[model samples]
Structure formats: structure tokens, C-alpha cells
Target: MTTKTRAAEIDALLKELYPRAEIALRFESDFQLLVAVILSAQTTDVSVNKVTPVLFDRFPDARALAGADPAEVEEIVHPTGFFRNKTKNIIGAAQRIVAEYDGRVPDTMEDLLTLPGVARKTANIVLYNAFGKAEGIAVDTHVFRLAHRLGYSSEKDANKVERDLMALFPREEWGALTYRLIEHGRAICDAKRPICGQCALADLCPSAFTVNGWREQA
Candidate 1:
């Protein structure tokens, strides 16, 4: 099958496997979602979620977080790892949003990128989830791993992998595909010990049954 057809088939199976797939981060507003996404860098969504309830409770909005003391914010977000930098970025981002964006998370990728700690991956997630705009795909660790394993792209850069995926899937499906791929990665296609035998896409996956040899010891 052609790459496009193969990609569609993979997406079809993923959509079925995770029909209700959604971003696992818990947030009630765009600002909160932005904070949660930044906090999620190199950290699990579950871990970020655990700290955000307390983080948001104290610094409820961009205006509030903009003026928060670094030490206090550090204490609250310490569990997410890289606390020092994460605190700095989130607080700086909040300050910028309040000072320039008028306390609202910028909807456009350009405007979003101007903020501290916001990159294309984070911008894509915020744009899609917060505003339902699919300008691009968010390539997290899972997406990067899955893209190569599934024969979608050979690029080492996440942005290049995202571009390859965008060429294959419809724009509207871009956001949804990310969630489903991440869900599949976390659920079955683990980086260390993928449960390939139970993966619904094993029949179609090029790397299937090849990388899970380490699972025998588990």
C-alpha cells in the first residue's frame, strides 16, 4: 500500500481503539490549559494535573500568576521536575499574557510563540484544544516515536515528523490523531516495553513485534 493509504489505515485503527481520546490534562480555561501544557514538558500529564489544582487555586488567572512570587510558584510546581525553569517560564508567560495580551492566552501561533516557554508543539495543542484551530499537529514524545515506528517519517526533529503527518491526515483530523496516537503509545506501544501482541495496529505497524523483544523479561 502507498504511504498515504497506510497512514489512513493506521489512523482508522487508532480512531477505533481510542474513539473518545481526549487530552488528559485537566484545565477549565485557556490560561489554565496553557499553564498545564507548559508544566507537562518532560513530565506526565497526570503529574502536571496533580500540581495544577493547587497551582491554579493560588494563582487563579494570568493576572494573578503574573505577579506571583517565584519561590511560592516553585513550591507549588516542584513536583513536575525542572521546577526552577518551569516556574520561571510559566510565570514569565503569565506576565507576558497579562501585560500584552490583556490577560488572555493568544489564539494565534505567532502571538503564542512570543510568550515564554511556548513552542510549536505547545502552541499546536493550545490552538487546537482551546480554539479548535488545527494549524498543525502536536508532536510529543509519543508522536515522535510512533511516527518513525509506523513508517510515517524518518526525520529526527518533531516538527518535521508533524509535517509528514499533516501531509497524510486531513487538517481536521490532525488534532484528533495526536490524542489517539498518544493514547495508543501510553496504552500499548510503550517506549521500553511495548505490548505489541495486544496492540490493535500490530498487523499494520512496520515495527510491530520487532521492538517488543524486551517484554519477555517482564
Candidate 2:
């Protein structure tokens, strides 16, 4: 299939399989989402969710978070792993949000990137979830793996994969597309062992049933 046709088919399959896919991070507001996203780096959503209630209770907004002690923040987020660095980034990001953005999370990618610890992925999450902007695809691990396995892109780097996906998909579907792929990856196309036989996109997936000699059946 052509790349465009493949993208469309994958898109349809993803929507059918994960119709309700949305942000997994538990947050009450944009600032909370930002902090949750930061803590989610290299950590599971379950872990982040476990710690964020107390963290958010202690520091409800950018102003409160900006004034919080780094040590206390680290202690609160310790369970998320990389607590020290995450604390620094969260506090630094909050400080920048208060100082520069008037205590509101910036919606645009460029402005969001100006905040400390705000990379393209985090910025994209905020823009898409918090502000309803669909600037480009957020190529996290799920999107990265699914894109290659579905024959959509072969780039190893997240940014390159993001770029390739942006070229392949419409701008409007970018946000939902990535979210659906993430849901699919978690539920079906797992990294270590994908449940290909039951996957809705198995027929379309280039890597589906390839492990365990199932490709021989193909």
C-alpha cells in the first residue's frame, strides 16, 4: 500500500480500536497536567497518578508550585523516579510559567518550549490536551514503535518520526491519532509481546505476528 493509504487504514483501525482514547495523566488543570507530564517521563501513569494528588494538594497552581521548596517537591514526587531532576524541572517550569506566562501555561509550541523541562513531546501534550491545539504529532514510545511497525515511518528519532507523521496525517487528526496509537500499544501492540492475533490492525501491521515464527504463516 502507498504511505497515504497505509496511514488512512491505520488511522481507521486505531479509531475503531480506541475510540475513547485520551490523556491518561490524572490532572485537574493545565498546570497540573504540565507537572503530571513532567513526572511521567520514564515513569508509568499509575505511578504519577499515585503521587500527584498529594503534590497537587500541596501546590495547587503555578504560583504555589513556583514557591515550593525543591527538597519537598522531590520528596513528594520520589515514587515517580528521577525525583531530583523532575523536581528541578517542575519547579523551574512553574517559575517560568509564573514569571513569563502570567501563571498560565503557554499554548503555543515555541512559547511552551521556552519553559524549562518543556520539550517537544511535553509541549505537544499541553498544547493538544490543555488548549485543544493540534500542531503536530507527539511521537512518544508508542507512536514511535507503532509508526515503524505499521510501515508509516522508519525514523529512529522522535522528532524525525514526528515530522514524518506530520507529513502523512492531517493536522486535525494528529492529536487523536497519537492518543489512539498509545492506547493500542498499551492494550494490544505491547513492546515485549504484542497480542497480534487479536489486534484489529494485525492485518495492516507489517510487524504483526512476525515474532514467534508467525510470519511463516503469512
Candidate 3:
């Protein structure tokens, strides 16, 4: 089958399996979502969610966060890992938002990229979840692993994998596709040991037959 056909099948099966797939990071506002995504780098959604309540309670908005003590921020977000760098970037991003965007998280991808610690993944997350925009696919570790294993892309880099997915899938499905693939990765196509035999997309997945209880066959 053609890549496009395979992509359609994958999308259909993923939708069936995860009709309610979404950004798992919990937040009440765009600013909170932006902060959560930034802290999510190199961390899990559960980890980010765990720390956000305390962090948000203390520094509720960009204006408040901008003036927050770095030590206090670090103390609150230390569980997310990379506490020091995350503190600096979140604080810096807050300062920029307060100064330039009137304390609002920028909606555009280019503008979002200007924030400290915001990359394409974080920018895409903010754009899609915060503003209902689809600038690009959010290629997190799950997406990166699944893209290659599913024969969607041979590229090792996240940006290149995202480009390959963009070429195969329609623009409208970009955001949803990202979350579905992430869910699939977490549920079945795990990096260490994929439960391919029980995977919903096993029929369409190239690596499915090769995966056993432990890992993908060489």
C-alpha cells in the first residue's frame, strides 16, 4: 500500500482506539498551558502536572511569575527535573509575555518560538491546545519512536520525522495525529518493549510482527 493509504489506515485505527486523545497536561488557561509545556521538556505529563498546582498557585500569571524569586520557582518545579534551567526559561518567558504581549501567551508559532525554552514541540502544543491552531506536529519522544517503527519515517531527528508525517497526513489531522500517536506509543508501541501482538494498529505497522513480549526483533 502507498504511504498515504497506510497513513489513512493508521489514522482511522488510532481514532477508533483513542477517540478522546488530547493533551494530557492539565491547565486552566493559555498561559498555564504554555508554562506546563515548557516544563514538560524532558519530563512526563504526570510530572509536569504534579508540580503545576503549587507553581500556579504561587505565581498565577505572567506578571506574577515575572517577578517571582528564582529560588522559589525552582523549589516548586524541582520535581520536573532540570529545575534550574526550567526556572530561568519559565521566568524569562513570563517576563517577555508581560512586557511584550500584555501578559498573554502568543498564539502564533513564530511568536511562541521567541519565548525561552519554547521549541517546535512546545510551540505546536501551545498553538494547538491554547489557540486551536495547527502549525506543525508535536514530535515528542513517543511520536519520534512511533514514526520510525510504523515505517512513517526513517529520519532520526524529530523535525525531520515531523516533516515526513506532514507530507503523509493532511494538515487537519496534524494536532490530533500527534496525540493519538503519543497515546499509541505509551499504550502499545513502547520503546523498550512493544505489545505489538495486542496493538490496534498491528496490521498496518511494519514493526508489529517483529515485536514480541520483550522487544522488536533484529
Candidate numbers, best lDDT first, in rank order: 1, 3, 2
For model 1, which pairs clash?
A: none
Off by over 4 Å in 1: 213-218
Candidate 3 residue-wise lDDT, 127-151, digit = tens:
9998889989999999999998899
Candidate 2: stretches off by over 4 Å:
none
lDDT (tens digit, per residue) of candidate 1 on 107-161: 9999999989999999999999999999999999999999998999999988899
Return the TM-score for each candidate structure.
0.96, 0.96, 0.96
Q: Total clashing residue pairs per candidate?
A: 0, 0, 0
lDDT of 3 at 191: 92
Among the numbered candidates, top lDDT falls to 1
lDDT of 2 by residue, 90-154 (tens): 99999999999999998899999888788999999999999999988888888899888888888
Q: Candidate 1, residue 186: CA error in Å?
A: 0.8
